[model samples]
Target chain A: MSSPFSSLHVVDLSGSIAGNYCSRLFLDFGAQVTLAEPENGASVRHVPPFDKDRRSLAFHHLNTGKRVVDLPKSKAELADLVAGADVAIVPQGFKDEIAKLAGDRCVCVEVSAFGADGPYAGWQANEMVHQALSGMMSNNGEPGREPLYGVGNRASYAGGVAAYITAMVGLFTREDDGQGQKASVDVAETAAAMCFPYVLQYFYNGTNRRRGDQDIPAGQVLCEGTWVCIWIYPHRFAAMCKALGLSQLIDDPRFAQVADRVKNWAEMFDIIQDHVRDEDAEDVVSRLQEAQVISACAYRPSELLENPHLAARQYWDGPDAQGLPRLGAPFRLSRMPRSRVNEVTE
Target chain B: MLPFENIRVVELTTAWAGPMAGRILAHFGADVTHIESPTRTNTWRTNKGAPSPVNYPDFDPGERRWDRVFLFNSQNVNKRSLAIDLKAEGGVETVRDLVLQSDVLICNFRPGMLRRLALDYESLSKHKPEIIVAEMPAFGLEGPHSSYAALGPTMEMAAGMSAAIAYHDGKPTVTGPSYLDPIGGFNAAAAIATALYHRRKTGLGQHIEVSQVEAAMQFIGPEILHAAVEGKDTKPDGNRVAHAAPHNAFPAQGEDEWVVIAAQTDAQWQALCAEMGQAELAGDPRFADVGSRKANEDALERIIADWTGAFDKHELAAKLQSAGVIAAPVNTPHDLAHSDYLRARGFYAEITHPVAGTHPHPGLPFHLERAPGDYRRSAPAFGADNAHLLGEVLGFDSERIDAMVRSRTIADAPNKEA
Candidate 1:
């Protein structure tokens, strides 16, 4: 059966990862987000992870619960749609035109790469470009090298979050005045600016913050070809060590104090890696959890789904008829909020 | 601007997350009273030590005013800061009274801690029926690992991004970006807004509980789905494009500068190749198809990079754009602050700070043509509107205000991190 979100009278005029990403949130929540195509479809149509049919993976991921309207909705039609919409989520550039078209009927929220007004507003950007621009890349990755780019568009995701929230605020504000209002969200590099606190310390704490190296894994041990990281951060290290048959290490001088161990992490890691490299990830993961350590089994995307924790949560709603898997909402209520739209009759 | 101009929002939060929700309201012209602890300076002041997140090493070799460059000022524009420690005597009731007259309550402490402080949903609902109470937790309010310790890195790793964000040839990396925190901040704001919409329809406020894990996990949807189905191995590809060829950042003319160029159709590639006077290369069998081009990316990258290396990034960007190729320079903070295009579009706005001088700061991301005016307030002083909050919201008398100040329960002044 088709999902509910495809039924709403929605219009999505977003490009790259940011605006499209944000609109997808509402789509998954049951908003009928129609990919409002102008001359060409969304820009990410060119981006990869494209389907077997050669459709952009970026497009597939974000537009899963939405429909694509090949023709652009006319201004009058756009206004008519918004007149009845509970919320209108638009990216920043189209805000002025959308608000003018919709007048006061729709609650308008716009998303942009940087802030609405500033010297850098019109700079061209996508995912990696914005990451560096946002000051996030500076704090990520390793030392003595170019800052590594994050997989998936972090800045874009941040912008999506910004857009989703801004629309909601407009939704609420519409209540007091009994009229819909306009709210523009500064997304892109501007929104991603606040994504790191430690990065801010580089500016604040007089410390130079750069990406760390592949050689020195933060708190992990180098073993063979892989880096074996121990599950003993400052907060819950003692408990994790107990399950590893290494409880004595909690009191051992080499690993005695959290501060000391942090200071001499490289050497300490060598000792730890020697012990745990041969141990299975499942065994190590289970033992650490049994000892009450807040630990996780770090794996690639494929292994993550098999994780015991996610399975217990039943996080997926199961793959739809299209053969793509689906995830649940990020926020949950006991009553459970229904997806705003229902299955399309067509 | 100031979309909620007349609406009053009461914020019971500290540090980052909850205050962010309040900031969003304030930015759009909501009258937000930030409830703080009288005795403790805003914990966010620690970042007060820097210039901006983009500026790497703030070494004041000489004493020149750098600026109050931190996250707090940007997140806290146009809001009222009022101090009232809930841990102190009568602090809980003081907040309760404010809630009665307010539209929303935002707090980002640990799950049960808010309840322990007597500032939970049940208590606030008593004061106002339609009062929306938003609770921001590091983890969810329930679950086995509910009461866990966390920060940005922890959350980034927890959400399956740490392993997913590795370099193509190297180990997994952590960007140190608070992967889901601000998203959590944004989600809290959105949830509060949606609930308020429901409340408007039904006249009932809601209890919004947002978890950082869920926020982080939201981004990991493809992976989660993949695991849910075929259970495949999805690792880092660095900057590689799985389905497209010649999609990588090529070095541009400045220190550590680069430009990303990607194209799919043969026409776009023909256009790019023609622009570079390398149309002959596009017809080569090795790069004939998108798949073949992606497969031979290293060789293709060399050809593209060599061409890009000669032209100035902007000129190359313009040339590539004219050719229907997707391209943009990897902008640094300096480039962002000073770009002419940003200035022309009026995307950045300048706000005079209490201490810092007029430095061009970023502003609202979206603009409405119907009412394109100013959003109210600038980055305010800590508890700058203490009197307004206490007297107006709680109906505190002059004597009571002075008594609270004397008792160190409230303060109109900041600790002066400057």
Candidate 2:
């Protein structure tokens, strides 16, 4: 199972969530990872939900399975680690600190609140700033209403991960050039704009993307309790009519034909919502799934973690130190390719 | 193999962030597997994959057609499935063995579940020093509310998305689900690739953890940084901008039918005023500067709407755009798929799902050079590749695999309820 480029070493110098996750990816794929810690140990260890030993469960879960280098008060040890470092995950672009350490050899992938050279460069920011500035909140809830953020710290993670990948691109490029270069990535609140849909509409049309309708032309503006950010396409569209016991929709003028339906999609959406309201969330979803129409529950974290398919998929274990047990890679490799589980000797 | 193609990744993750991280590696051609148990299927029932209950019956295998919609099929292509009973002893070792032999191990467990299974960072490192482990949750691995439960909405709200919408002028609005999951995907992919790059340099594996809430917040930097720097609230401008005039989504003849128009320059504004047959309006002082126009958007919108009321949204959008005014129809998913530009860009690809039949879904957002990017196969069934993976990757004997399966350690189906 060894890869031809299996000789890489990745050192993760991060505190809590974002940067560490970036490094763990390298660690998982057969790369050597060195988890460095400050003299006080990981700040995450003191956060909360301590184990019986009073150690942070969340910290333990994210920081396990790696050797730790306690930074000296002299700050020289940090320099040594950076000198040997290939990629450094600095969410806020600690350029000066990283520059002194990673120096010439290392590539610094700095994740910033805005961008490196923006009007808001030196401004202090976190997840909240990023989400709001991206204009995503504009279309999130009822039209002409206040904006809402995501259910999770999705922006920080998004910036962190996007920054990490950008670092990889630098790495890939370095491979061809046989030279390493430092890259500054600005993962601001605008970073996730592409995923919001219709960038062209925004760029060319001056469209405000943050509005949601309870029942609009194409879909419903859903508010299903806690899992707030989810917009749903009902399962009973004419295409899925056969699956929803409403096969008659396939022949109905308004409901029949993808083309015709597209023309009257707004009215169609409202009509679909009328039927959807009659059914409970689960029933509507299950029925729609059966019919093969695109329908989703627009779930929240708890609902997602509690899914039977996730259970059936064995995707989670239990709540770990971080929050809840989660799924990793989504596939299975060969287990009979002479695999052996190595246990470090006591 | 060039890198991780020969490497096996055991993904014990659900939802989008974590699973998608592994899915990307799979796309790069890794043997990524998913773990499942009967009780673990409750996460994102509507958003993830499932059977279409209306057309397909739940109990009847014939009626139990698989849920292969955009979200599921988009991420899960080219992966294998395995059902595991993590509570069982042999099941624990099975994961450990899988980790030992795997090139990468990805999981999105909240914060602490790895230790209970003895597969935490410390545990796995003992088994395989160079193993990559990734973790993502509602928040980061640390914080006051790190352990709290939330989906994309809650996270977005926590990140201040509600505060930013400011459209209604007072109450906060939440951005909800729009880009939360996909943002996680993009960031997770970045993190995973960075780790891989680091490993390529160090030969050492590390633990990577991400907080979805934090990740999503980064996108709203304008407000965040502005508030931080200016100590002022960035109010919502509706569809308008701080520096532009006549910017907004104007209503059309139909409900949910609208056109977004931005006249950034004087010439653009002149063209718009001409289109309205009110060429004299552009000369008015009240609508001269962007500031003047901002103060008079209501009357301006009324004027624009009156002009727009007669034409099709798409037709008008095209006409305005052709005039060099930034404009396009605000599209729905169906409209998006059928769009001429998107079609020309090859934004959609049709493929046959093992259970869901032939359909199109949004393909890769990021592309690589010299890469043949296509959905190689539909998502694998539960334990669909158990024997094949066990035999081909782990080199297990048939008797051993059969015994393990019989023992209910590594199952092709749910070995036990969570």
Candidate 3:
């Protein structure tokens, strides 16, 4: 039941989402992660949504399963501390200085808004800027309006995921050759990497796909008292027609082919909407499931809390420093034991 | 030499998420053998599941349409494909033999489907005690929704990600791209790598399960934490941070061109004002500090937009960045496809697939100076490695391989129905 990274030690000098989460994943793998915070605590600790007692939940979720230490005030002290570490995740701002401090045994992972040597590397950036810099905002949210970033800090989270993978790759390399190498991630590039073959499509054909509206009336619509999303492929559309007692609609010339359905999508949606207007949400869901249609009920956050599936899986971890329920491990390993230090961020 | 040169992976997966995980493992130098049923071809290879342009290299799928499918081809590089029918008489033994020789096994079948196939972790572990099984189920294995089927969009909704990502005043929506799929894939790859590391040390294998729903939650961790801690629900804030002023995508000259400018700190604000030739604005009471500027955000945006409207987004971003103010163009495919920055870093590799010809593909997200990943091999054709895998790796004689092929346990093409 020993964790994968049980033998490793880490010094984390990352501030915001990306570097911090990278180190946190290492912590989850049982690496002895030392969160090196400034004297006043990390910037996330001071961000909003504070409780009546002024504790930040962002910090509560991010700083679990790791011990905190005051970042060394001087270069020599920093060097002394990093000398014993197997990995050091440093922010772009302090990458150079930290790289010099990290010993040969330690791998230095630099996380940045752009990259280490890009022209935009020196510019200050947040999650939104990165979303824009990448093409994420272009294909997200409502079309024609100002581009919108997603609700959460997606760019930073993606950057963190990239950094963690890079670190693991580095560890894998080191395991063979006994050489811990340097790795880095550009937040913008990381976001772009997740983008569907958009760039490839653009390169192949002259098409710049724009952001479509989130609630495309045709794709997601209200069925009775519940929101349900439908991915209407030709096969699924036929099945949906059967489920809604509109079997004849499948043969209708206006909705027969994919192009015809696209042209008359509004009418087709209305017909489907009318049929489900009075049906129970659960009934609609069951009918669609039975018919093998590509459909899902739009669940809200509160509804997710009550989902019998999530409850049975026990996905939520304990109340951390701010007494907030945090998500447990992103993945589970049957034999590898998870962290038991639930009340961290001290 | 590649970092994962010694690693071997047996991929039993379908669609984007699972294939993407196998693709990454291949990129990292794992000897991945993709096992698909010839009778039940992966959905991505049939019909128009392939991505644009490359799917039809000369604007045609030619003779081997499945091999040319861009979606499957793009993610299946550097891997061998083995088409084995699990339902066939000798199919189970074919897979079991491959499993015995593999280091890691991966699958994304619905919760109980693998167990029904008698290839679940428990069943596989009994045969190969050192096998690392990475299971990526849509909802997860032991849940009420576990038995329910899903694509990325549905899983996103089930995970509450769609709700959180909606516009401030709009309904929750789905991304054009399945955003959570790649994230889940990346997590799966990382988990397998870590598990491999652990196995190397302890000589034991473990069952690793990565739920698409759970992995999606990591992106919205702060919001969930806030709601759980302070009973405060976080509303969507489109392109704007609470404390950062001038933090939005401002219009530029071209049709959809825009630039994001964020003056997070006082110096950045001063620099932005100076770059816009409105140094006097920095001294204005309404825009003096973070709090005041946030309060007067509308007015600030108007003034900033007026200046930004005259120049192209990329050009303006450069000017702002030179002055130490935060700025970047809201780039689309057009801009990204021809990016000088990406080119300078060698971010894109020109990979030549047999059917797709040559095209630019994204390199690894991170750079490893010493032992970088190798993208030498193109995606395998349907059951391309059947001869080599069965004859060489399994040490099977030609007669045995021929017999399996004759019985339809091995296939060179998808089933006639497919």
Candidate 4:
């Protein structure tokens, strides 16, 4: 089968996860990506968890299938590649340069920490700061405690996802007119969108959300042995009572209405917690699932890698240099087999 | 006026994840028609007579409450609604007929539920071999946990994100709201577009599977990959970076107000020190360089916090940024909503629905200089376009459509009190 991007070429001038991952998505689409890296290679190569050969596990996962080009390429050589390519994935700072080189046939996607031309455009930030600045950290920890930042550097990946989406829209537009466009995706805005209706509600009600801000306390509940984040939607009140075997609480006036339930959430959580303290997390989730209430076991990274469902769906790309499975594309396409370039070449 | 002018998407998704993808497609100009039935009205639309948390204008959901849900209105814009009870006798055939004319199909049902509905890829492809079907399951289609149901929070837990980002020394905690749902939706939309590109070239339609769990993993890919390679458990370290000093959210003057400051470079560190009126601190050996500063991050944090505590967050952010140090106020929802830059960029779209009234909706996240995404229509009311889509687009006669509607095979509202 012909790949979606067989004729497409990409100049990946991104060093970190955001731009690299965007290029990786293009690589998966069968576009030939030439990663432009510094003389010592990209900074990601030096990140932790290296193989015996000292190759970064992170770098191997994102860059294995793409070709690497040393940076400081002669302006003419770089311009030649950009002129013929379908996409140029660059850092926010390099937007104008890439745009000039791309001419009219190549789409330029600039992924930045703030945005391309914001007051904070020249500011330095990474995942941690982006999280803090985006109100994500504000809603992460317990009340009275200093806010927490989510594990894993997601701010950058969100930027990458935004870049990918923008690139696709650009390409789709180009499909008709043969004209390319420029796209700028700010990591902060992308992170904000991930929070969804919360952001919307805040705008509607003028309330800033905080950690433990829900009507019910949300966290890992230890069932017999597993940990799970049990969602407690107001409409599922009866189902939850049945699932937790607290059916008596269903008619209690303190928990009768959504507003009342929210007001008495702390006490209600205590009652529910006391009942489930001895049960297994998986067991509790099973009961909840039976009642059509939402719940699941809290997964560790190792557990996720070994998850049977992922194996069944072929969501891993085989062992990397260190004999660890690499995460596959976030989505799967049935007819066109996954590029599987690294699995074959590595 | 958008990129996907000729594309048509038939959505069978409910709740946040799948519908969000449909929303994006619609925003970009795809003719997205949401398939619903009285039996399976989306939970977002069937808010049980209660004042939905998603209500707009801060008003009670009046008589036509189904059409007033904030979630439904926000997510279903630029899309039409067609209520077809696939559970009805002829519903499957009707959808098959519709599928034959559409370019793409999307659903987020549990893995086998679609198969049970005879709406899985194999069955749908039988009708139109060149149809792109995007399936977003909470878990992947074939995993042991595939059958397990998950909302956004649970999936975040299962993806190890909850555990990884907890309070310092606390157990794993859920982030605010259903964080991964939108991310999953965005990825699904991108995947669908990519598949459409493939179909355009090869004249083949494929089944695209997006697992919310896997999508969450991609967010923390390098960290999880590290855990796999290093065989070590990772824990949440609040606001701490491996190589940056002064890399924490510091308290400001007001309650819960904060400014995040990061001084990664020596020049930035000097700038920060100068702004704090402690330029001499730049000469201190303990915090002289990135390595030393990271080694003594605790001390650096306290010192910075002490200076930051006396100032308002907004002022501190401005002062730091002007000094060439990276800083930004921890934006509340109001701050984001009222952002001058965001407003100036036309990032908020005000869409007016008859029942829900007018409200601000987020414009497209990506800025495409040439065909920017815009709202062409407000979200449709339940089954609002059943007659138009079935009769006009699908060429179904009014007699058949009316018969289906009378049989409870279609409805504009929930068949039972939802």
Candidate 5:
């Protein structure tokens, strides 16, 4: 069966991670995506996590399935590229020109840091700045320490996902009246959306939720030198006790009820930790799973490549043109198969 | 008309991921109806037979507290609710009829629950060939761990995100909030929209499955590639990226207040030095280039932190940004709730519910010029739309509805004893 977007055409001109990721989604579903890069190449090409040859892994990951072309210097040539596409992912600065060129029938998604006309529109910012301002970093680390940010390009990736959704929505709407429109996706706002229940908690009350040590019925425990995360709610307390050989604590008054467990979480956790400390991480996880308790070992990056579950699902896509492994399609469609990544010679 | 004005969605989902997909669709003007089971209530509504204090308004779990929990209310906005026991007599037939007329159905149950309930994609497609079904499982449907249970944190760990995002001490840590849930939610929405667009053209519908772990692994694709090409594991470097230096959060004047600064370019780094009244530092050999600054990062961080510690976080952020440096204050929840920027942009909608009261809720992240999304109403109360849906949409008579209610197939309140 043909891919869902097999006939769709997309032009990606932003050359940033956010723009590339949005276009990558289209490419994965068999869209014809052309990436226009500057003479110096896209900015992601210069970013880190380089291979042994100093080639950027970030660039290869983001630009694997798309066609690369030198950005046209002439306005007419650029306009021709946009005019031929059903969708154009443009930077904030180029939205007006691109939207006008694609005129009325193509969706133009303007991806930016703070958005086109906001107070911080012209301000210089990166992924870290976006995370900080979006209330995500504040609740990440221990309260007295410096706030933590995610490891990779989190904010940009989120903005890209939002932009992809925006493009799809615009196209779906255009089907009704055959008129396209311009959409704006702000990285800062997208980052804020990721910080969900905490943001809602503040609106519910007047308190700023702080990050601290783990509490009872949830959190990480050291099992044979590996930190395994386990999540348990009130409903699972009894089953967890029986599974972990803590059945003696099931009737303990201090831990009998949810409120009591919350009040005495520290003591309860210490006892739970003692029971699982000497067990192997995998064994502990298996035991927890057997009883319907959610648990997983915090795996290193290399470990995921060898993970049995992902391997069984055939979730890795490459050793492609660059001879490096990549993540497979984000979602599966029963009617269409995922397209393989091919070499795109510059 | 709004973007999704004519679309109708049936959401049989619990917890953050699935409901979030329905929430986004509802926000964009889809008529989304949530199917709830009184016997097995959504975990977000009650943590331990009662509402968690941190989830309810003002730490108060008043009467009908299920309707007031922020955890459920935040994600269920602009959607209607109906309580139906799928295990009851004629329940599966009622839902099958609804699906035959609706455009989509979304669920996040483990792999086989829908199959057991006779509501899986294969079962439903037999009735409505053009109905879209989106399922989000922690793992894929046929994987070895497909039937294994998972929550947000475990999903993150299984996906290799927690291992990559570690502190300076190199201990793996999960993000305070369950980050995978929202990411999975966004992916599900994107998939459904794509399928919808396809159906509009071909008159065909398909089953879409979003593996939550795989969706999250895409975010760290570069790290996975690094691990593959180099034949080595990538260790977590706290708050630092390989591309930039002086890229850490520093303390501000107030207690627990901090600001993040990232001088991504040489010009930005020089400008930051100038703003700190230490132009000589830009010329210093040890801090002259990205590589050199990274080599002497500890010293450079101390020098920058000393300069930033004297100013307020927000003021310092603005001052630095004005000087061409990328900077932003670490905003706590209180700061976010009272943010002037968010208010000016209309990112927060003042939503009022009869039970939960009026509050500022976060709105859509993106905007479409011609078809903007709106927050039409607050979240629904339990079974708030039973009469309207059963009578108007499903064409069930009042007597039949009453008989179903009497048989406990439908309920207006939660059933504590199943």
Candidate 6:
């Protein structure tokens, strides 16, 4: 099958992880993405999670399927490359420069920390800072304790996804008018969008929503030494009780409705904990799932590669130069399978 | 003109993921129609089949509770709603007719439900040979766990995100909101757009599948690769990055308030030290370089925390940012809703809905110079466009529409028992 982006070329001029990720999506769908690396290297190359040889695993994962070229030293040389490309992914600082170089024929997407024009524009922020400012960290961790910022570069990754979607929208607009346009993706705003429900909760209630407030039978519980995450809403309460061999609670007036469930959550959780205490994680999960309850064993990173479901789906992509298995395409297009090339051509 | 001005999308999705995909297209000018079953309404309308304070407006589930849900209204803006019983007679035919006019169809049903309803790609392609179908299953269509039911938290656990994002001493933890749902939504929208582009070029339609779990693993791809190469999992380190020291959230003056300070470069480190009134520490051997500071991060963090604890979080963040240091207050939802920066960027739009009243809604993350998207309309009331859709778009006469409504094939409200 022909790839969706087979005829397109993308030049990635943003030296951050977000830009690489945006271009990576293009390459995955079969566009010819060329990473225009600086004289030293893209900044992400120096970021960590390195292999034994001190090579950046993050950089490898983000750039495996793309071509790499040293950034041009002169404007004329850079213009030559931009003129041939269908899209350019650049940092916000270089938005105008790239737009001028590519003219009105190449779609340009600018990735930034707080957008090109905002009160916080040009402010310095890493992933953690982005999380803090975006309200993501504040929503995580225990309520009274210091908030936790999740691992990895989530804010920047979200920015990349937004950029990819925006770039496609730009391409569609260009198809109509025959003139490419510029778009901007702010990591902070993208991160904020992910916190939609919680933000709305505040708007609706006029209260700051905090973490660690699980309703009855809706939080993590221990089962045979493995923590299994379960989310049982009010309607599923009776079914969960019946499935977990606590049917006696199904008839208990104390656990009848939403308010009562919240008031007696601790007592109900203790009963659930005692019931699942000796059961194996898999057994407990299967039983709850059989009742149509949402549940899963919290898996470690290594265990996911060996997950029976993922294995059956053949979701892992490769054992590239470093002999490491990587994640496959985020989404599959039946008529356009993703490219699986594992080497970068300079 | 808007990017997707003439495009039409039919969405048969219940929860966050599918509705989100349709919402994105709708924002870009696609005329998206969200189809809900009268007997099995979107779960977001209620808290999984029961009224909950969190999902309602001002904690009130009004007379038409399903239409007044905050969760549903937040994502369903710019789209019309149609409540129909696909299991009822003439229902399948009605949807097939709508599919004939739609450029795209998106759903997040369990893998086989579409095929069971005769709405799967193979079935729909026969009617509208150029229809783009996108499905988001928790797992893939043919996997061992293909039929397994999953919510956002369970998918996060299966995707390895929970394990990668915990405190040093805590077990795997899910985020406050299920982060995986929106991620799945974004990926699915991107996939549909790509397929639409492909069809425009090659005159072909395709089925796109997004395994929500697999799509989520992309965010932590480097960690997965690390596990593969090193044969060991990277332990969860709370609020720290390998490339920087003093990259932790420190407590601020207010109770439970905190500020994040990330001194990634030497210049930033010097600025932080000067801001803390300890410029000499920047020259100390144990804090001079990134490696040294990392090795002594505990002591460095302690020193920084002592200084930060005396100031208000917002003020501290502003003070640090002014000194060329990377810093921000750990913001609560209230902080975000009232952010000057967000206000300046026009990130939130004041959208007024018929049932839920007017409120500020978040805008799209990206902005195009010429074709910037907007909230063209508020979320539809229950089946607000049912008559319009059937009468105009489907070309069904009022008599036939009334007959279908009498038979419960078409509904303007959810079944009371349901």
Local distance difference test values of all predictions, in order: 0.61, 0.53, 0.77, 0.77, 0.84, 0.84
Provide the lowest-lDDT 10-residue window in model 1 chain B: B56-65
Q: For residue A47, give model 6's deviation from the true position in Å.
A: 2.0
In CAPRI terms, model 6 is classed as medium
Residue-wise C-alpha lDDT for candidate 6, range B277-333, written one tens digit per residue: 999999999998999999999999999988999999999899899999999998988
Q: Per-residue CA lDDT of candidate 2, range B1-418, in tens?
A: 2234565788887766666777667766677887665345524223234433322212222322223323444467778876667766667677677778886777676667776777776778776777877777665655434454455544555455554453535334444344556666566666566556556666767676666654554444323433432334455544555545776666666655556676766787888887777889989988886778888978877888788867886778667755666554545433444545434434456656566555554544323232223566766655677787677766889998888777776664432222
Tens-digit per-residue lDDT, B197-261, candidate 3: 78877888889999978887777777666565544455555666666887888889988678888
Please give the C-alpha DockQ score of model 6: 0.68
List each candidate's DockQ score.
0.32, 0.07, 0.55, 0.54, 0.70, 0.68
Interface RMSD, all models, one decimal each? Answer: 4.6, 12.9, 2.2, 2.4, 1.5, 1.7
**Model 6 chain A: which ten-residue window has the lowest total lDDT?**
A209-218
What candidate 2 gets wrong by more than 4 Å, as runs, is A1-140, A143-170, A173-346, B1-7, B42-62, B65-70, B403-418
lDDT score of residue A187 within candidate 6: 85
Clashes of 3: 0
**Per candidate, chain B TM-score?**
0.88, 0.89, 0.91, 0.93, 0.95, 0.95
Candidate with maximal TM-score: 5
Off by over 4 Å in 5: A213-216, A222-226, A234-238, A241-280, B47-54
Q: What is the per-residue lDDT of model 6 for residues A196-279, given as tens digits with 9 covering 90 to 100?
A: 566676776676766665442567778876778777777898888888888888778988877887888878777788878888
| Decreasing DockQ order of the candidates | 5, 6, 3, 4, 1, 2
Tell how far residue B192 is off in model 3, in angstroms. Answer: 0.6
TM-score of each: 0.79, 0.59, 0.91, 0.90, 0.94, 0.94
Worst 10 residues of 6 chain B by lDDT: B47-56
The residue-by-residue lDDT of candidate 1 on B372-401, one tens digit each, is 435455556656787887887678899988
DockQ of predicted candidate 4: 0.54
